[model samples]
Target: MDKNAATDAAAETPTQDTAQEPPLAGRVALVAGATRGAGRALAVELGRAGATVYVTGRTTRERASEVGRTTETIEETGELVTAAGGTGIAVPTDHLDEDQVRTLVGRIEREQGRLDILVNDLWGGEHLLVGSVFGKRSWETPLADGLRILELGVRSHVITAALALPLLVRSDAPLHVEVTDGTAAFNRRYRENLYYDLAKNAPIRIAFGLGEELKEYGGMAVAVTPGFLRSEQMLAHFGVTEENWRDVIARQPDFAIAESPHYLARAVAALAADPARASRWNGKSTSSGELARVYGVRDVDGSRPDALAYFEEVRFSGKPGTPDDYR
Candidate 1:
C-alpha cells in the first residue's frame, strides 16, 4: 500500500526458457493506492507481464494527499507501467469516497469492458505510525489519528472491492489481491496497537469472504503481505539509500533481511499469471517470502529473503543465527 522504483531490466517482459508469451498480454488490472511503494511496484510488474494497468491514488503531479509527500505520484507510476510495455492510466481517486469509487469502476467498465485483476493496496498510514500506534493503547491513542488509519486501511479497501467486483467478476480468470502488512499467521499476535491490528486483519477477512463469494464465478481472492520491506520511506528512515542500505544493518540487524518492494509485486504478478491459482491460493493469507519460494521468485538482488522465517526462527525464538541463515 505504500514504495517506488522500476528498473529497466524489470520493465522488459520476462521470457521463460520455453519462449512463452507475456502471461497477461491482454489482461486489465486496477491497482488502488499505487502512488508509491508496494502498490506502485505491483502496477509496474503487472504491466511488465503485459497487463494494461490502471494506477490509482490520491497523489498526483498536480496535487498531494494527506500523506504529504510529493516525491512519488500516480502519474509517475502510470509512466513506469507504460514504460514496462503495457498501457497505464493514472486515475486520481480517494477510495474512502463511494461515489468516486463507483465512477472509477464505471470508467473501467466503459473502457476495458472487463477487469481481470483488482488490487486493494490502499493503506497510506505510515505517517501516523510513530506517535499514534507504536507505543499507545487503543484508548490512549489520539482518536482522530487512529480513526484515520482505519479509514485509509479498512474502509478504502472495502469501498474499492465492493464497487470493483461487479466488473472484475466478468473476467474469465479474475484475481483479487488484498495487500496488507503481515500474513494472517504472523499477525495472530497483537500488532503493537489495537487499531493497527484491526486495520491489518480486516483485509485478510475481506479476502477470505470474497474468495468464498467469488468461487461460483471462477474468481480468486487472496491476502498478501510483504516481508520486512525496503520501501523508499524505510530507506530514508535508516538514513541510507537502497545502494548503501547495508551500511545501516549494523545499527538495525533485522534490516539485513529487508526486501525490495518489487518482491511483493512479483508474487502478485505470479499469482495473476498462474492458471491454477484458485486451487493454489484462493482464500489464503500468504507472504511474499512464501510465494517466492513456491513460485521460485527472487528479490532484485537475487536472494529470497524470508523475513517471516527469520523472525520466527531467530528473532522471536531466541535462536543463535544471523539474517543470512534465513535469507
Candidate 2:
C-alpha cells in the first residue's frame, strides 16, 4: 500500500482523544493482514489504545512479496503499533497456509497466555484482480480461483480463530472483529462481479455464524465495513493526493465521501474498549460511519462522514449525477 497515502491522509486530520486513558493497556490483540489498509490502521489504533498487538502478514522486510501491488511489510505495521504505545510483534505469515497460521497462533498463546481481541482481515483479493477487474464471470472464473479467495478471505479466519480459541476463551473480555465490505443485505452493484461479491460477503456470514457459536464462550463476533477507503493505492489509482483528495470527487464522485483507514481503526479501538460492545452489536455487520455515530469518534478530518447514509439517501435516490457531485 502507499505509505505516503496513509501518511498524508492521517496528517490532514487532527489527532483524536490521544490524551484519554488507555483502556486496553493489558489486553493482547492480533490483527491479521496488518500489512496495509484497514488492518494496518487497526493494529496501530489498538496499540494507541494500549494493547499489545501481533501484526501478521505475508509482506516482510526480508523479501519482496507478490500480492502484486504496493506492499507494506508486517515489520512496518508492527513498528507503528509499537510507536502508538502498545507492544507490537511482527510475525510474517501467509494466512492461507494452515500450518503457518497455527504456528503464529501457537507463539502468541505461548507468550501472551490469553488473546483478548482477534481481527480477521486476511484478504489477499488483490491477486484476484486481473487488470483492475475480475478475470472472469462468476461461473466463468475457475472454481479453484474462487475457492482460493474464499480460503484467504474467510477460511483463514476460521483456522486462525480455531487455533487461538483456547486462549481467547480464557480472556475476561474476548472480542472478534471480522473486517469486511458493506452488508450482504445492502448488496450494491458490486461491479457486477460474482467471485468478488462472494468473497466480500463471506465475512458477514462468518461473523454471524461465529457469533452464534461463540456466544456460549462469552465472546462476540461482528463484521465491520470501512467507508470508501482512501488508501494510498486508491489515491494513486484516482491520481490524487490526500491533501487534494476532495478534488478527485470531480472525476470519481464517490471519492468525496471517503474515509482514511485510520477512521475505521479508531472505531474498532473504541468498540474494543467498550465493555458492553458485544451486547450492542453481536452478530451484526456494521459500517465505520455507523460505529462512529454510536461511539462519537471523528474521522481524520474531525468529521464523521456518514458515507453509508450518503449512499442510501443520495446515490440510491436515482439522481442525475454520481456520488461525487454531492460533495
* Root-mean-square deviation per candidate: 4.4, 4.8
Q: lDDT of candidate 2 vs native?
A: 0.81
All candidates: TM-score:
0.94, 0.87
Question: Cα lDDT of all candidates, in order?
Answer: 0.90, 0.81
Model 2, residue pairs in steric clash? 1-70, 253-324
Best by TM-score: 1
- Residue range with the least summed lDDT across 10 consecutive positions in model 1: 1-10
Alpha-carbon error at 232 in model 1, in Å? 1.1
Q: What is candidate 2's lDDT per residue for 1-327, written digit by digit as tens?
A: 256745665565435466775898899999998998899999999999899999999878776455755457889999999998899999999887789988988899889888999999888676566743375677777777777777777788778878777778788767988998787556555745676787778788888988887788888999999878887667777788779888886667677789999889998999998889879989999988888878877676666676776787677776465444322
Q: Please write out the lDDT profile of model 1 over residues 175-254, one tens digit for every residue.
A: 99999988888988899998899999999999999999999999989999999999888888888998999998888989
Model 1 lDDT, full chain set? 0.90
In model 2, which regions exceed 4 Å deviation? 1-21, 130-136, 142-144, 188-191, 319-327
